[model samples]
Every structure is written in structure tokens, then in C-alpha cells.
Target: MTTADYIALALFLALWALYSWLTAGSGSRFFPRLSLNRAMAERRRNWIYNSLRRDLKMIDTQILAGLQNGTAFFASTSIFAIGGCFALLGSTDKVEDVFSNLPFVYYGGRTAFELKVAGLTVLFGYSFFKFGWAYRLFNYCTILFGALPMMHDTNADRAKAEIAADQVIQMNTIAAGHFNAGLRALFLSIGYLGWFAGPYMFMAMTAIVVFVLTRRQYFSDARLALMDPVSDTKDKQERDMRT
Candidate 1:
């Protein structure tokens, strides 16, 4: 690989890590702003703890099932992606031949092509592991959910119910954290595919991807919807009382 490829790769990795960190634990003093991921995490906590007061937890169980199913689906997708990358390795000759004739394509030679494929393989592999672990964590959260005191029992000792719910919430959040990491990798792979065009293209695409993701996490309509609007309403009410 040339110096430009190395620099591009480094840029890709650094942005990936930075975005991951920013979207992770929104409680960090460094960020100061909440991410959509963290906001959803709070909702998850509310969901679990709120179930304690309900007579039937069928809804909660179904939510848990949905989480497991979604994780499984992504995990399967990652596996398929890994298989596709491996298949690509076997067809590098054909790919290089095609690159040779395409005027718009930047043929980085066999070594660069192979390196790019290997990197893609690693990305998919990382996503697979993340999803796998997330699935297990969700399973653990299910068990923890089951261990939560029954509605009748919760009525007797609300504190105990709170403690148990907290456990499940933490497990669910951790599972979600892994799932988010995997999803982030999947999104970045789209940009990583740009390497076939050239390192500069790769760097440009990676930056574009990061910008899109950051906007979605921190400045999107989804984040606005998830944010609590009680403060504005409460302030309005206070002003009315003053009048």
C-alpha cells in the first residue's frame, strides 16, 4: 500500500472510533450532548422498570423477543456479508481485469485490492461477533426479566423490584451497546467499499459516512422526537402562574 492508502485507512479508523465514542455512554462529561442511542437507552430503562407495576408482563416479554429477533437478523446478515467477502477474494483476478479496463476506476494493483478485501472481511467479522455477543446479552436480560419479582411480590417490596429492574435495564443497555457497535460497522462498510476507487475516494466516502451518522445520532428528527419536551411546557405553565 502507498502512503496515501495508509493515511486514508488511518483516517477511516480514527473517525470510526471517535463516532463510536460519541454515541456511546452519553453520560460522559466530555460529550455534554446526548445522543439518540443514549436517549433510547433511557427509554429502555423506563420500559423495564415500568413493567414492575403491571399485572401482566406479556408486553415486556414481547419487547424482549423483538430485541432478540432483531439482533439475530443482523447477526445473520453479518454472516452472509462475511461469506460474500470470502467469495470476493476468490474472484480478485476477475475484479482486477475489470478494473484494468474501466477508465474511471483507480486500479491500485493486486496487493491493494487484496488488502481492501481483507479489511472488509475484518469489518464484517467484527460485526458478527458484536451481534453474537449482543444476542447473548439480550438472552441474559430475558432471564433477568424473568427473575424480577412478580407483580404481587413487587407490591410488598417495591425497593426489591426496583433493584431487580435495574439489573435487567443495565443488561439490556449493554446488549444495545453491542448491537449499536455492529450496526455502526455495517454502515461504515458502505463507505469502506469506496477504497476500490482509490484511497482519496475512500477517505472522502468515510468522512461523508461519519457526517451522516453523527447527524443521525445527534441532530436528526429522531433525536428530537426522543427528547423530553416537558421542560418547555413546564416553563410555559410557570409563566402562566406568574401572570
Candidate 2:
């Protein structure tokens, strides 16, 4: 409820937006690297396209089931988190007393504390909706995947098969995007907890969280592992030229 508090909240929101923009694949020139999300999206397309070439699709359905189950689990967790936030609000007096006694803690009275709890509730609610929608989209994607032409039909009409496969790929990608958004909110909530301590700690924690996430997206070993080897690509190009 202070000027510093307002500024810290603004910075927190700005950093969240910035991270989203960078990871959504628009900051490639500045980053000069492919993100893990984008790499996995490519893999999703490959997976869908590969299904068009196969007859037995039990494995593909299993993968879809796994994706749906994961999204459902996160959705359920968000609901639980929202309930916990409400419970926290109900016990504000006890928490406020604890905060007052703690060294280096900020107790901004009942109203401010309530507002902070409200914000946390909103974050969890947003995540819940995202995960819920992702779960639905994944279900729809499974239906689309099932509708894809069989191997013989695909061979007869490859163009139609490609179009059908592209549909499945797009649906799967969109579902994944929602799921990632939900996960990001959950991660950022950790930084938000610093606000309960003080605005300065809030800003520092938000910066630290963003730094870690950005590093993971651009520089982590997982990203490096996903990258296609330069030598392999060059060799493939040379082989194509010779052929």
C-alpha cells in the first residue's frame, strides 16, 4: 500500500510479461538461440506427422493420455492452491501476528495483507483455467489424431493426410502453450511470496526468478541437448546436393 509496494508490483508484472514475450519465440535475434519450448513444438509436429505413416497408433494415444493426465493434475493443484489462499485469508490475524514478530518482515495491516492474498488467489485461478482449457484442447487433439487417414489412405492422398496431420499438430501445440503458461504462473508465484517480506525483497526475488527462467530457456543443458548438431546438418545438406 506504499509507493515502493506499487512499484514492486509493477516491476513484477513487467518482468512476467517480458519473460513471456522472449519465450514465445519473438526474441530470437536478441537471444540468438532456440528455446526449449520451441524445440519441443517442433518435435510435436514431427510426432504427429510420423503418426500418419504408421498403422498401429496405440503409442500415440498413450502419449496423448499422458499429456491430458498431466494437465489435469496441474489443474487440480491450482484449485487446491486457490483453496489454500482462501484458508490463508481466513487465518490472517494469526499470520499477521506472526509477521509482526518476525524480524525484517513487513506487516501492512489487514487490508494490504488481504489484497496480497487476493492477488495470489487470482494467479492460481488463472492457472487453473489455463490448465483446464489445455486439458480440453488435448482431448480434442486426440480426436483429431484419431481422424487422421490410415497409412494406405495417406499414401493415396498425401496432401489430404498432411492437412489432417497439420491440424493435429496445431491443436497439440496450442494445448501445450496453455499448459506452459499455467506452469509459468506457478513458478512466478514463488517470487510473489517475497512481497510478504517487503517490496525490496519482492523486486530482488522477481529478478532472480526471471533470470533463472531466462537462463533455462536460452542456456540450459537441456536446450543444448535439443539442438541439432551443426556437423550432422551440414553432412545431410552435402548428401542432398550430391544426390
Candidate 3:
């Protein structure tokens, strides 16, 4: 492979490694404070409590269930997209040949490149849509949480309601996690297209993509907020206590 191809490959691999590291959880000492379990638990509990208490006004349990279902549908779609990528990989040569046969072919025997580009484009489009929708759902869940008052009468039977809310929030967070994972897979798969250059170049490019993703996960505010629930819950508690 040419030096340029090797450089591209190296960059990709580096990015992948970085992505992995940044997204890694509290299991590692470096990210010990980045755990989101507690916040997610509280959110779920609140959802259930609100449902039981009938505090959600026009928003019923059925609607909440529907929201969950919608997210599931998106996740399923992403899975199909991944399958499509694999299928494209298997039919790479045929895809290139078909495209080459087009009257407008201009790149001169670069049909494989065209196919690779198309595959990556599709994958990225799928990932972006999935992740974007997941983010919106998460925001919706947060708004639902905001609608319910944190304070409950000590004698009120709110345990079940709290549990339900918590469950919903946890599920939403899990959905977000799945969406992020889908994006990661898409990015890695795109990097895999580097195999057209050479095996070593492919490996290097994969690494670079890994590194880029990791850095974003580690340093991005969105990641910090999503992963560290304790701080968020604490803030909520403080607000409730003050009121």
C-alpha cells in the first residue's frame, strides 16, 4: 500500500482506540466517577411513582409505553442496517461491477471505491438518524421527570410509582446506550472499508477511528451527563429540598 493509505489506516485505528477508552465505564480506575447507574435508577423510580400517583396529567402509562416501543423500533432498524452492511461486504465486487456498468462511470475501474463510499454513506446515515432520535427520546424522558414533583407525603403509597418511573428512565437510558453502540459499530465498519487499500492500512485506520470516538466520549459534555447520573440526581434532590 502507498504511504498515504497506511497513514489513513493508522488514523482510523487510533480513533477507534480513543473512542473505546472514552466510553469505558467505572470498571476502570481512570473513570471511576463516571458511573450513571444511580441517576438512571432514580429516573426510573420517579416514572413509576408518577404513573401510580396519576401525577403525569394527560400523559398516561400507555403513552410512556408507546415511547418505549418507538425507541425499540429504531433500535431494530439499526440492527437491520448493520445486517445490510454485512451483506454489502459480501456483494462488494458485484456492487462495484454494477456501478461500473453505469454509463456515467468516470473513476476508471474504481467501482470498489464507489461501492465502499455508498456503504459508508448508508451506514452513517442510519447511525446519525438512530442516535439523533435516541437523543430526542432521552430528552423527552427528562421532561417527563421534570413534570413530577420530587416531594411525596411520607404516608403516601408512592413506592410502586417510583419504581415504575425508575424503570422507564432506565429503559430510556439503555436505549440511548444501544444507539451509541450502533453509531460505534457504524463508524468502525466504515473504517473497515480501508481493507481495499491493504490489511495493514485497514488496521491502522480502524485504530484512528477508535481513538476519535473515545476522545469524544471522554471529553464531551453529553457523555459526562449521560454516564454520571449521581451528580444529576444530587442536583435534582437539592432543588426539591429547597422547594
- Which one wins on TM-score? 2
Q: Per-residue lDDT tens digits of candidate 1, residues 108-210?
A: 8998898899999999999999999999999999999999998899999999889999999999999999999999999999999988898889999999999
Worst lDDT run of 10 residues, candidate 3, spans 33-42
Which residue pairs in candidate 1 have backbone atoms (N, alpha carbon, C) closer than 3 angstroms, thus clashing? none
Off by over 4 Å in 3: 1-26, 33-54, 57-155, 221-243
Residue-level lDDT of model 3, residues 1-243, one tens digit each, is: 346555654666566555555454524566544433333444555545545554434565465556556656655666676566667667767866775566533322455464555656565566657666775676577565555444463126456446545655665666556566555767687567656555565666676766565545444444445543464675445445545
Per-model lDDT? 0.90, 0.91, 0.57
- lDDT at residue 81 of model 1 (Cα atoms): 97
What is the alpha-carbon lDDT of model 1 when measured against the actual structure?
A: 0.90
- How far does residue 107 in candidate 2 sit from its true spot (Å)? 1.4
Highest-lDDT candidate: 2
The candidates, ranked best first by lDDT, are: 2, 1, 3
Candidate RMSDs in order = 4.2, 5.0, 9.4
Query: What TM-score does prediction 2 earn?
Result: 0.93
| TM-score per model over all chains | 0.93, 0.93, 0.46
Residues 145-167, candidate 2, lDDT per residue (tens digit)? Answer: 99999999999999999999999
Q: How close is candidate 1 to the true structure, as a TM-score?
A: 0.93
Task: Indicate the residue-level lDDT of 19 in model 1.
Answer: 88
